[model samples]
Target: MLLRLPTSVSEARECLAEGAVPIGGATLLWAEWQRDGFPALAMSLRGVPQANALGPGTLGAAVVLHRIDDRVPDVLRLAAAGVGTGAVRRTATVGGNLVGSTLRCLLPAALALEARAAVLGPDGVQETDLAEVTAKRPLLLDLRWRDPVASAYIKLPADPGGRPPVTVAVALHADTPGHRRLRVAVRDGYEVVEGAAPCDDNIENALRTLRGTALGDLPETAWDAVDAQVGAVLRAAGDG
Candidate 1:
């Protein structure tokens, strides 16, 4: 096994170009190694300044989950704080969570917030929608988004001792004098509902579609919980 710790973004890219797998925190990779063994070459992004940078509306890819404090929006903060456990939070990076094969809480939250990602790829760094970055599984450099009027997140576990199968995030933004824009992102889908207020029927229908198409066949009880949380978030945002 070989490890290369790059101190700058360019250095990191060089290492990556040599076929070294990028590593930050290594929380997910650790699990993979435990099951499937290690990669031949790995580059640590923790030492890269650009990957560790964090500011209002901008989160460097290497920023650990625990570092996502009050500096970010409540929805994002809550979602980060809720990932895995305290130890996992300390070791999981924003980039890892966003690009992980499995659904992580942060993805839905980021999508709901309309966050964009700065990706470092073969062509160089480009800013694109977070969804696109997730699908393409590129090297995420940072994430940026505009401040939202309000946001919320919820996750329901598949079982008492299992990962959550249903995760939802909602962001509310002021659009017109008497209306608001609602962005709802589920574990595997996203929907936008614009009106004077969030319509229950429309949101429910969207969730149903998501459950059927992307999220698999979730039980009605799970949908009920999602409905309850969505309502609570809307109320907190002064819409309900």
Candidate 2:
């Protein structure tokens, strides 16, 4: 199998039409290729429509991360930073993250924020809820957001090994007073354990896990212990 590394959107479209698999950052996909030897044409979308444009807070195709960084909530930017490391962040597309099913942290934050997905398929451009696309369809392109809102992504470590978290959660909150809403999602790797839009139940459940007996062994309570550590970091960042 061959790999087509395109530097622009037109080339990406051409490769897709040629039945090639779109690859962003080539981090997660390459890892899988090395481990499993899954042979498929690999296509790279680096520097095509621009790097930061596919972030979770934009409504249009032009709504990249660089453009919406000032407006999106702080937690989301933190999740983006956590997407692999510095090198991956520079090359990975938000579109690729959602498609790769890498983890729930970043996508859930976008979902909590009421983000949408913008896809340019064989049929042309189409739009739908970003979370829905991730949950259901084989997404093609970028992720987007509808209304003005606040979003947060959380990851909780398991045990004292200091490993990457086992459970990841995200929340999106509406800005309006009477119309306020929250969405929370909990996942391990690419598998979703729980998700609630207008997240009263999940948040209550999360807080409960910390306060009460562990429920269903989902790490809801363990996260509370981790929250303190995460909070200190946030506080330090704020102080800085």
Candidate 3:
């Protein structure tokens, strides 16, 4: 197998003209490689400085999972901290985590961040919502989001060692009400409710629903914890 390690984005772009696969943490790709055998050509982003760029809005694809905890939004850090063990955090890349876990803790945070993603491939680059990138997809280059007043991520069942069954990400801009800006992923899928982060009204509304309601369906074991978590974040932001 031949691997091309490019130190710059332009160089990396220049390579894989014939469609060599790109590898960041190799967390997901490594599994496929083991199952289907190695590809003829692979591009490694480990040497690419541009692949680890981090700023208020831009983050490179090769940034490791652990590093993001301190660098990213508060909620994003919570999600990052929940992903596996220390060694996994050290080796896993943000780009990998973005596409690896189905019931990912990061998805809600990314949504709350309103993150946009750039895909780098033989087609040059294309930008889209971070939530649009599926686990089956590849070639992510970077993620960017505008700064908000407050953002947070939290999970249910209180397990930091494994993926949670439900996760919520909340974002409140200075101009926006903190109680209303929330997006939640029930499993691998989620929706941004039309209004509010969920409170009395939401719970009451759920009681009126016929079936399949989020509030109605919330597991008894996790509801109180979820409520408290959301409350704490809002209170920290002085919204409560």
Using TM-score, give the best candidate's number: 1
Number of colliding residue pairs in each model: 0, 5, 4
lDDT of 2 by residue, 1-240 (tens): 687866655666687788887665565677878888866686655545642353335522222233335445555666666655566666565666676644644665564455666665566557776656666645355555554344445665455434446544344344555443444444554455433333223434444443342223555454553354333433333411
Model 1 off-target regions past 4 Å? 34-37, 161-163, 175-179, 188-223
lDDT of each: 0.73, 0.52, 0.64
TM-score of each: 0.79, 0.64, 0.76
The alpha-carbon lDDT assigned to residue 196 of candidate 2 equals 39
Write model 1 residue lDDT over 20-62, tens digit each, in one string: 9877788878878879988999987788777887777888899
lDDT of 2 at 105: 47
Candidate 1 scores a C-alpha RMSD against the true structure in Å of 4.5
Q: Candidate 3, residue 94: CA error in Å?
A: 0.8
What value does the lDDT take at residue 111 in candidate 1?
75
- The local distance difference test score of model 2 is 0.52
Top-lDDT candidate index: 1
